[model samples]
Target: MADTAGDSCQNLREESARAVDNAKQLQDSAAAFISRSGTEEQSLRQRALAAESTIRKLRSSLDASVRRGTVDVGVAEKIEEELCKAGSIITDGDVASFLPSIDHGTFLKMFLGPINVRATRKDVQLKVKEEYNRYRDNTSFLFLIFPSALLLLRSWLWNGCFPVLAVQLYQAWLLFLYTSLALRENILRVNGSDIRPWWIYHHYCAMLMALVSLTWEIKGEPNCAHKQKGVQLFLAWAMMQGVAMLLQNRYQRQRLYTRIALGKAKRMDVVWGETAGVEGQLWLLYPILFILQGFEAYIGLSLLKTALVGVVSEWQVIVCGILLVVMAAGNFINTVETLMSKSRFKAKMKRSKSKQELDQGLPPCNSRLK
Candidate 1:
């Protein structure tokens, strides 16, 4: 019995020893696995950081190349020369005498002279001139009629003769005028002309409409709901048309200006180093204009909404806000392009002037000669 008991104890001790050894082996394996995983993770992080650094260096190099190589240095020099010449010409004459000549007709004659049909055989130039003339004529007509129509509307409304109809008609007329002006401006831009007058007219019309609307709202009784709804619809339609006009104007103007500048440079036997900058400037202006249009749209929409629903919704406000942001971003890009082009152009001009001075065996002037 004693021997049998001793044998059982020995078997149990052997079994326990085997179990402890297996546990130790498993623990060692687990430790090894953890150490290897940590090392691999650290290596991946290092590699990622190295890759990012290389990308940054590459991006910087690319930016530098674009700024120095892609930019038109020659064009910038030419613009500088032209500006100098213009400044001297203007300064030589009596300032007071030249002030009156700053009118649209005179300004156009001088500035457009370089790229006139006589200088270049470009179809675009002719188209631009035609468009500009049309805009001028239309604007003149609007100016002549708007005031008289407003007076008539005012009198009719005061007399309470179909007051709602009179108000609606007046609003319709204003809408038509603004819409026409916006469209003409866009067309002029497409033809490569700056429609500054149209821009001014649109703003003026908007202001006038707002005032008139406010006045009518205050003075007249809320009797003609149907006519008021019609007026609201007209305003909305006009606003939509205006936005479309602005978009078309922005894109067409950019193309037209770019082409006109190029044509001018080619005709004058001059390279504009600042073409990129000018383009960038236009890009910047575009976004700003877009934002402005968005704001205008928002205002018009808000007015219409209030008139219709008697309340403005959060969603509408959010939509307007988003549009404004997008417009601003577009403008920022445009501005950057213009500034860069201008800088490059100026640099090219300086280099050309320096070369000229050296060739002539003359000292470089510190200031540009007026």
Candidate 2:
């Protein structure tokens, strides 16, 4: 009996000791976390102060230069170069000049509700960018796979008409998708990402399309096939977009990595709206993209025609159709501009190569024929 009692007391003592040790450890961890957070906050404040100081100094210098009636070209060039470091796709000047109204903050507040989503450090920024790209890739895959499922339901399972609830759910998803995309793009921009304006605007149009689609009446009572035309066309367009997103993610990613390796692209460079093309991919990519744009236009025009011809006159249909047509036109114009720039770049490279070869072919000035 004595031994048993003694054993129980020892066990209790040991457990008490362990509990005390764990409590001490927890207290230490709390202190360390508090210290670490304080340090981080201090660091961030210092950085902000430093940036403000530098900006003030620059402003003073610029003011002085302006008072003298001539700013030094070297100083101006240096400022531009420093600003350009934000991105190859967008000059800081361009971003500053483009939309002075409301700006990124308004959109951020509108979509994400005043959250601080921008990462400050370089490593954090890169990680944010990587995750953003992955988000895009995953969504592209989803769109690709999801639409096929919908197509199957429409054609085989549902007998050529999508369920009303299913259509509503799909439209809701589209709204969420576009809202997420736009929010992320805005955050990325704040983090010094150089995405193009058109890409951001494209998401805006997509969001509008999705919003209007929610109100669109999906029916088969009156005209049967005619009533379902817009939804059918929209599903088809979604499929095309999915395919384009997949190809762009694949080819553009590979090209971006190669360019980074060659030091031809900035580390921060990303594929926004498919400006430059990889070798041998121009033929494969551009044609498909162009075809997709044309098809988008066709869908838009069809919807508009249906409304005009009294096939199905809904305000939702008209609004969605206009948005689609505008988006398609914007995409086509941007693509053509990209192609033209690519052509110019290629021509310049060829001319430079020819010049180099001609120079090499000539005999050295000091070389005498023996």
Best by lDDT, which number?
2
Cα RMSD of all models vs. native, in order, equals 23.6, 7.2
Residue 282, candidate 1: Cα error in Å is 14
For residues 179-258, could you state the per-residue lDDT of candidate 1 as single tens digits?
54454344333333333343434344553553455345422344443334334333344444444343344454455456
Worst 10 residues of 2 by lDDT: 91-100
The residue ranges of model 2 lying beyond 4 angstroms of the native Cα positions read 1-103, 358-370
Candidate 1, poorest ten consecutive residues by summed lDDT? 266-275
Give candidate 1 regions above 4 Å deviation.
1-128, 140-344, 358-370
TM-score of each: 0.29, 0.72
Model 2 clash pairs? none
